[model samples]
Target: MTLPADITERLARLALPSQAVIDGAHVDALSGETFDNVSPRDGQLLNKVAACQKEDVALAVFAARTAFEDGRWRDQGPRAKKAVLFRLAELMERDADELALLESLDVGKPISDARNVDIPLAINTCRWYAEALDKVYGEVGASPVDRLSYAVHEPLGVIGAIVPWNFPLHMAMWKVAPALAMGNSVVLKPAEESPLTALKLGALALEAGLPAGVLNVVPGFGAVTGEALALSMDVDMIAFTGSGPVGRKLMEYSARSNLKRISLELGGKSPQIVFADCPDLEAAAQAAAWGVFYNQGEVCTAASRLLVEASIKEAFVERVAEVAKGMKVGDPLDPSTQFGAMVSERQMNTALGYIAIAGSQGARRVLGGGQVLKETGGFYVEPTIFDRLQPSHALAREEVFGPVLGVMSFTTEDEAIALANDTVYGLAAGLWTSDVNRALRGARRLKAGLVWVNGWDACDITMPFGGFKQSGFGRDRSLHALHKYADLKSVSVTLR
Candidate 1:
């Protein structure tokens, strides 16, 4: 896993955000423990990051609780919170390059994608909540003129946000922005695989004039640090984005602790259906190719299943195969690289194992079915695709969470919807059709939280993002997110 001379030099000069941020300062783990953060680019050691555990979580929760109870943040007027958040957004924009670099190095995403997509989106999220903080309005209950009854939204106090590694900073902001904008303190427990930006974000929060203990970051394994946060009684709410098992565990922990509110955004085995009368076959083919393959297919709402009409299935598959083949998979640091390595060797192995399982189950792999760039000792997987995959097959049913897509053919629209809804996931789905009636029908009939017609992943931060059914409850973005972070209380007053 060797890097080029320039990249090596740049990495050496780059300051890794390795320490945990607690009470507005960077500190080593109380246990003095550290873990090796290896680069997926070349399997090389990037740095030894603080392995914050239960003790760290306690400290962070205490900080968050103190800030909440003391009214250091929760009592701040909306304008104060807005100013702090706006400054934080400015800081993020200022450090965009370094943030993008840390994201790429830590998450194995391309630098360009980090800079163009994740970083900008995170900044926008911060600004969006900041700009909208003062605009949030409460309700007025209908009552007699002699009496007044009104409901006001109040902060939920200490919030524990546990975000995943795939898009660490971006996902963290999705929870952090609104939580903070609602005048609540936050304890951020970032995924172990990519903790750099979260740690940096905590520091940036302090720099943005957020009161001490308003934002704290602890980085460690899920079993240790994450468990502590979930089980903490001081936490008022747990906003989590990860796997289903973890989400269930969070719920159990919530009940076992203070019955604190828990919100989860989990996995999806989203299907992209294309009718024979698709308005643009080429456009649909491109969407099918990038929807699952982008971000190494680590997205929870990735269109992992392609359900197409039998008449154009072969042609559509060929176009997708061409796009996958042409995509360059190499170093994440390279701006030109379209695809990058897996976040870890373990993830690469999981994807490969899934590919093998699909083959054994009789699914035909139309494109890449194995690993590439093995000589570099890096974790890399070629964009893989399977054809004519049966709906009951494991590839089509399970969430691979990788760059592997299973294409299934359908004769009718009803069959396509059935094939799409057969899975346990109901996160997101997409359909491409030229018929306006069919488009409306499919968009309504699809069993998903978000459905895109004639496109894939076409929505943005302006829309609510989450899943239905087993994909977990609660949402991450849009104005709905603000309501999730606050509690409504009705006050009645009588005037003489």
Candidate 2:
């Protein structure tokens, strides 16, 4: 596994921390077991990390509950919490290169993306929540002549966050930063495939002067670590980002246990609709290619289904294919690689399996239908596109977390709307049109949590980000995220 001299030197200078961070200290698993940390970059074993189990999870949760009950963090004023978060964000910025390198090596994303996109976004997310901390206000309600009534948002005890491998650090902070800003302690379970950055962030949280037990990280498999967190009666809530099946199981765990609040950000088979009268076909094609190929198409809201007006279907797909072919696929540590390896061998195989299924189902492969760069021994797939796909085709309906796009054509506006909403997932959609009326109508009619106009995946911290229907409920980004980590209390007082 060859890397740039600078990156190689940095990797050597940094020592990988294997123990889980609990109660502001790094500790080994209670069971004394460890798992090999494999790099998708070259199918090499990076190191062994503690394979935490239920016993470890229990200890972490107990510590978190103790901290919350003792009011170590929960008792702090909003401004105080904000200051700590700001400090944490500063620490992240200072160690930006190291964090970016860890994320790239762990998740197989391009180093440029890890540095420029993921790290910056995560830093901003933390800073955004920190800045908004003291701005949240309690609400006053209509009261009787002699009485006053108001509602205050109080922090929940403990938030159990199970983040996915796709955007390890960002997703963890999407839950962690908000929960902490709202004054809730958190126990995080990063995905088994990529736990390095989450562990690093946990250490950073401690270094930021966050109270002991306010943030804990248990790195292990979902079944052992995540399931334990979900089922633990001491946990106050469980926030997750993963597959629909796992999300459903977590909800079930919530019900069967103490009915802890559950916030899920699940899968999506999002749509990208392009009308014949699109304002800019060239830009639309570029956005369409990015929507499905960015992050190796592991994004939950990836625009996998492309619905174009029949008149411009061929031209639009051709344009998108050109952009796909132009993308650079190689070692993630490379500075110029646009696309990187899949997170793991399992995910790479899953993507290839879907490609094979598309061929057998009679869909025509327009471009990039198989694996590429076998010499590197890294998991790589071509930026794939399939045409002649029916709405009911499995390739169009299922969430294939890979760089595979399916193209379909529609004759009327109604048909396009219907096609976009035909799936159980309603995470996000993109619509391109020249007519103002059509754009407004399409945005209103689409059964998705977020609708992009002439763009895709252009999200900011201010906007509420989540999904509708089977894509799962509960928002992630905006001020709305605070609601999941808080409990509203209504108070009424009689005046003399």
Candidate 3:
């Protein structure tokens, strides 16, 4: 795919920095190691960033610990923290275009999505958390006649956040915003594949008047920097968003360490059920395609398993296939491109491998199962669908984490619920029905942590987001996020 003229101009104008931020300053890896930032589009080199390891991770954790203990940030009033965060959000908005370009170039996401969805959501999250800082308060409890009692939340010192590459900026902010808003210092480890935006955020936070060492970015591979953060005894909490295996490893690290608080938001093979009672089959089909195909189906809450009523199975699948076919794939920088390259060659291969597995399993391919744009040297896969799916089939049970959908038919609500809840994953589920009773009942019965009725993957800062089973525990957004970053202390005093 040829780079558009405007994209070329932006690429020429933007200069991506390669160092990690520690104590509000850019620095090289202690071992002087670096890793290439390969653009999945056309397989070009974006830049080489510091490959932070145990030494750098130790430095960052120590900095955060010092900052927290100094009382510069942890003792700051809510209004002061709010002011700095608001400034940080403003700085992000000011550099929105540059951040978006870097995100698209580094993560293989379309520039439009980076600009319109990822960057804006990240900024709004910061602002939202900033506003929330002053609104929450401690509480006083009814006590014995001779005593007084109250409860207050206190910051948990230093926090470690390991974020994924799919939505690098937004995911980082999901951890950073609330943790900082609650007056905790943080060390963030961005995924190796996409570290540019997180580094940029660290710089912006410093420029926004965040105190030194309060927000540090360690850019490197997960095995090194991530593991170090997970195992760091100085860090009080570990908040991670990634695969289940890694999440489990972090939990183990916590157990082996100081038993610090651990919050994990992991994988999902979420189900979207379409009933004949849905008001509009066409809309449902369109939504289903968008739910699975958005972000190239890299979303944790993507509706990848489509369970349709037997009456509408054929029609819904056909319509969804058409919708998937209509989505364009090309250069991520192009404004018209709907789906861009996969994050890397390895990821594309993973998606293709899943397609091959489906074929071998005798699942019928409905549309798209092969590589697209083979001439471009980009990691691109066609939006794919597989039918003849049993609840136990690999395609239905496992998270393909690409634009692959598994289709099945159910005759009754009980069967639909059973098939939807069959997988160990319970991150999210979607159902479309005009019957309010069925919607309510299905939502209550779904094993997933989040249920969407007549909608899919719509999130608000107000809602708690997490999973029920192997998908991992603990929520990421809303007021619930504060719980992960602080300790609630109960106080009682005896009357003289």
Candidate 4:
């Protein structure tokens, strides 16, 4: 396995912490089990992490529960909690470079993206939620004659957050920042495949003045630690980000065990529409390339389905093909690389299987379609584009979570809307058009949770983010996310 020149330098500069830290103490797993953190870039062991089990999950949850029920975290006033969160955000900014490096290595995202985009966005998300914490207003309702009604928001006890391997550290911050700011202790279960940065985050929280047990992380397999957290009766809520099937299972488990509040952010096959009225075809083509190819197209809101108007479909696709041909896919730690390897060998295999299935389903590969640079020992796939896909085709319907774009043409606005909303998942969609009326109409008609006009995947921390249908429910990042972690209580007063 040959390491990319840039990765070799980055790895040499990385500073890794020892495996265990719990309640301000360094220790191993309860059973002394350890797991290796492997680099997807070269299939080499990076470090050892505590191989947390069901018992470890129980311990972490118990710590969180104790902290929420009897510790300083729950006792801290909202202002104080907000202050701590702000400080944590500042600390994140201070360590941004190291954090970005860790995220790129653990999750296989481009180094440039992790440094310039994901980490900064994550820090802002925490800072934004922190600022919003003290400003959240309770509601007052008018009552008849002598009575008054008012509502007060209070935190749920302990929140169990299960984050996916893709964007591990950022997703963890998405859940933890708001939950803790709202006075809820959190038991975070980062995906086992990319758990290094998450474990590191736990220690950083402590350094940033978070009390012991207020934020606990257990890194392990889903079947054991993940399931335990979902099924724990003591847990007040579960916030999960992953596939639809796993989210459904978490919902079931939450329902069965004390009826915990569950917030699910699942998969998407988001559509990016380019109409005939688009002002600049070249600009739209570049945006389309970044929309689907960034992070190797593993983003839940990635525009996997490109719905081009028949008038300009051929030209636009040709431009996109040219851009796709130049995407550099290699080690994530490389600052110059645009596309990185998939998160793991299993994910790589899954992506290849999807491509094979698309070929069997009569879809024609227009450009780069198979494995690339196989000699590198890294799991890399070509940035593939498949054209002539029917609305019902599997390639068009399913979330590939790879750099595989499915292109289909529509003739009318109605046809475009139909093609966009045909999928069961409704996370996000994009429309490129110069017509004001068309943009407004498409925004209104699209079934997605978020609509991007003339661009794709443009996100802000202040805006609420979630999905409409099977893509799962509940918003993250914004003040809307804080509501899920809080419970509303009404107070009625009688005035004579």
Specify the highest-lDDT model's number: 2
The C-alpha TM-scores of every prediction are 0.98, 0.99, 0.99, 0.96
The reply for model 2, stretches above 4 Å from the true place, is: none
Error of 3 at 285 (Å): 0.7
Q: Rank the candidates by lDDT, best first.
A: 2, 3, 1, 4
Which stretches in model 3 have alpha-carbon errors above 4 Å? none
Q: How well is each residue in 100-193 modelled by candidate 1, as lDDT tens digits?
A: 9899999789888998999999999999999988888988889899999999999999999999999999999999999999989999998889
lDDT score, residue 473, model 2? 92
**Candidate 1: clashing pairs of residues:** 1-42
List, in order, the clash count of every candidate structure.
Answer: 1, 0, 0, 0
Q: Considering lDDT, which of the candidate structures 2 and 3 is the better prediction for this target?
A: 2
In terms of TM-score, which candidate is stronger, 1 or 3? 3
Which segments of candidate 1 are over 4 A away from where they belong?
A: 1-9
Error (Å) of candidate 3 at residue 206 is 0.5
- Residue 297 in candidate 1 has what lDDT? 89
Residue by residue across 1-496, what tens digits does model 2's lDDT show? 5678998899889877799999889999988999999988888898899999999999999989999999999999877888899999999999999999999999899999999999999999999999988777899999988999999999988999999999999999899999999999999999999999999999999999999899999999998899999999999899999999999999999999999989999999999999999999999999999999999999998999999999989988999999999999989999989999999889999999999999999999999988887887788888999999987788989999999999999999999999999999999999999899999999999999999998888779999889999999999999999877889999999999
Alpha carbon lDDT of residue 386, candidate 1?
A: 95
Name the lDDT value of residue 437 in candidate 3: 97
